[model samples]
Every structure is written in C-alpha cells, then in structure tokens.
Target: MSTRFSGKVAVVTGAAQGILRGVALGIAQEGGQVLLVDRAEFIHEVAAELPQGRGTGFIADLETYAGAHAAMARAMQLHGRIDLLINGVGGAIRMRPFAEFEAAQIDAEIRRSLMPTLYGCHAVLPHMLQQGRGTIVNVSSNATRGIRRVPYSAAKGGVNALTTALAMEYGEQGIRVVATAPGGTQAPPRRVPRNAEGDSAQEQAWMQEAVQQVTGSNFFKRYGTLEEQIAPILFIASDEASYITGAVLPVAGGDNG
Candidate 1:
C-alpha cells in the first residue's frame, strides 16, 4: 500500500519506546518527516533508528510549558509546519491504594499525565489553525472508563474532554482532534523495586505474574501489540478519517466493556 503521509510532517511526543515509538516509526514509514520528542536519553538512539534523514530528536520534559514550546519550535524550525501531532507522553504510576497516596503523588501524577497533552495541543493548535488543516491524536488509556488508577484516569479523562472541545472549536477551521484509548498493551519491563541494585530470579517471576494478572483484566486476555495500537492512531490522523472528529476511538479490544 502507498504511504499515507507523503510530504507530511508529524510530531510524536514520548517517542523513546512503546506506543509512542510505534506511532513515530509508523509516521516515518508512511513517508512523513517526524519530530521525535522524549525526556529520556534513549530518545536520540530511537530517533536515529528511524529512516535516515526523515526524523529528528528533541530531548525535553513535556511536563513543562517551556519544554513543550521548545520542542514544537524545533519541529517548526525543522519542517516549517506540523501536519500531524500524536500526543503520546503520559503513563500511569505504580498502583497505590487511594488512602495511602500523598498529596505530592497526586501533584506529580497530574503534571506527568496532563501537562504534556495540554501543552502539546497548545503549541500546535495555532499553526494548524493558520494552515487551515491538521490532525491531532491524543493517546489516552482505557483506565478512563474504570478506576484502575485514580490520578492517571483523571488525566486521561481530561484528554478525552480536550479532544472533544478542540474538535468542536476547530472543526469549521478544518482541524480534526481525536483521542485513541488503547487497552492493555505489552509494556516495557520496569525495574523491580524501583531502587534495587541487581536483578533477582524470584523478583522476575513475581513481576511476570503481576503482568499476567494485569493482562488478564483485558477481555482479550492478552496484551495488544504496538502495531495494533498504532493502526487507529494512523487512521485518525490521516485524511482517510477526514469526516471523523471529536472521536474517542477505543483500540482496547473490547477491554473497556
């Protein structure tokens, strides 16, 4: 099939790994110039792995307005315009009981999950409006439908609200704003105990069990693949989905039900 993004410029935040990486690579594979933004040092490595000369990397913390502005400025300087934006920077913190969660924990969660999407939209919306067309896809989580993680759920729910509000505000200006909520997808391995100095076989086994339990919560009884999650993002960001706006396309494999 022909690449759907020939001559387009796409920006993807949190492009170091997982669904963000998938979205960035997918856009590049579709012939779009990509601006890969992430806070991790590995973001440079990941950006280098994209098709040569088609991608650029920016290391910035999306939790800050200055960082988000800088990333968007870099993209505009590199490509002149952003045709697509995939807001993919947010994630859940480790599970903790509501009563035990401290005020600082709530603050951190809100910053990590909401600031990125909000600032990203702020940075791109004006240029898109001026260009008279663009697509913005915010990556939310299925947790929004359930109280899996309180602060994270609240953040993603905000994302859904932002998507709809932007769509309604910009539909006449030719911008399409949408959200894609993915179900349980295979996540990268987290370091056991957060501060452990070495790996342990027993810990590994326990981690595996925990992962399995999480996946079991999904109706499909398996974690979805990165590609499967990216498919809906690509569709929503493409002209093929021109008529689609203010949509919350759940790529959750029926897990939200």
Candidate 2:
C-alpha cells in the first residue's frame, strides 16, 4: 500500500459493509484519515476496528439532503478538510423485470442508487470549492447496459452523468469528479442482504437470470474481487490520477458501461 493519502481526510458513504467496507479499510491502510458514513451503527464498529487514529464513523442516511449535509458538516468539523469523497452509497435494492417493478420499488431503487451520489456531491462541493481542491469517486455499475433491473441501471447511469457534469463544471475550481462502474464483484456474504427475502424458487430463477445477463455482458465472464474493484477507485481518488477527471473508469472486466 502507498501512503499517497497520508494526512488527507476521506469520506466514504455506505461504509458499513460489502464493497464500501473494503473501500474504507483500503483507504485507511493507505494512510487516509477515513470517516465512514452509513445508515447502520455497525459503521462505528468498523471505525473502532481501524488502526488507532486512522478512522472515525458517522451514521447517517446519505440518500437525503439533510443527511448528506450533516455528514459533510461533521467531516469538516473533525478534519477541517475533506480531500476525497467516495459516494459508495448504493446497491441493487431488488432485481426484477422493468414491468414487474411496482411504482414504489422503482422509486426505492432511484432513492437508493441515485439520490445519495446526487446529494453527496451537492453537499460537498461548497467545502471543496472553498479549499480549491478535491477528488470525488462515485460508484456506478455495468448494469447500465444489462437487463432485469432497469431502475437500478438508470440510477447508475445518472451517477455517470453526475460525475461527468460535475467534473466539467468544477475542473476550473480544482475539483476532480469521476465514477467507477464495477461489474459483478465477489465478496463475503452480505452481513445484511440487500433484500429481506427473495429465495423462493421463482425469485431464485429471476435473480439467476439477472446474474446470467450480467456475467454474459462482461467479456471476462466472471466477477471481480473487492480488492480488484477498490484499486481503480483509490487510484482515481489519489494524487496519482490528478489529471484524470470527468471520466468513468469501468472495473467490469470489459463490460463497457
């Protein structure tokens, strides 16, 4: 690991588990002073498990304006500067054909996958602007070009768009905005699954079909590991990729997003 981020403050949303957990740990290992934000209290536990003085945690629902703002405010309060903002606050809430999705489910997907990035970027721009420098890496998905989860795909597409527009708008102010569209990524079984229950025979088939669609869409025809997905994101956030902005780096093994 490189101490490229030594003394920098990084804020990563969805820091409770899964990809975000791996991202938070990697950031700390690279010498960033990380602030883990998630809706779950377990975020605090993650912070506690970090090396002494390496991390802190904040529990907030980042999908909302108020929650996003509060998280940013707290980061500014603790570290006085937020050099990196990783908007990892998203996932497939449910997988179903577009027509099969209820109105509420579509709304839920957008809120889960879109609102956080939108709100997070909006909330943090003021601080980054005032400091005249920052880097943001929003998590997106290759599902934008696949099937069965139209709403989630649309939401991630929105993230890509957000990344491009923000980087263009703020490039003059010394802020770099980028996104990573990760493909199927292998990781530990979720500490909390995305859904309450979906293991029925039909649901299994639907879910499996979604998997097939995703796997086939990628040239590599396999999932990536947590570390594999985190590397590019960390690179894009670090000073090493200082000249790269307004770009979406796909970590989907050739599944162009």
TM-score, one value per model: 0.89, 0.97
- Compared with the true structure, all predictions reach lDDT values of 0.82, 0.90
Clashes by residue pair, model 2 = none
Question: Which residues of candidate 2, in runs, are more than 4 Å off?
Answer: 197-199
**After best superposition, candidate 2 residue 4: deviation in angstroms?**
0.6
lDDT at 47 for candidate 2?
A: 91
Q: Across residues 114-182, which tens digit of lDDT does each residue of candidate 1 receive?
A: 889999999888889889999999998777755435777788889989999989998999998998988
**For model 2, what is the error of residue 76's alpha carbon versus the real structure, in angstroms, after optimal superposition?**
0.9
How many residue pairs clash (N, CA or C atoms closer than 3 angstroms) in each of the candidate models, in the order given?
0, 0
User: Candidate 1: misplaced stretches above 4 Å?
Assistant: 190-217
lDDT of 1: 0.82
Summarize candidate 2's per-residue lDDT along 19-72 as a digit string, tens digits.
888888888998999999999878999998777899999989987999999999
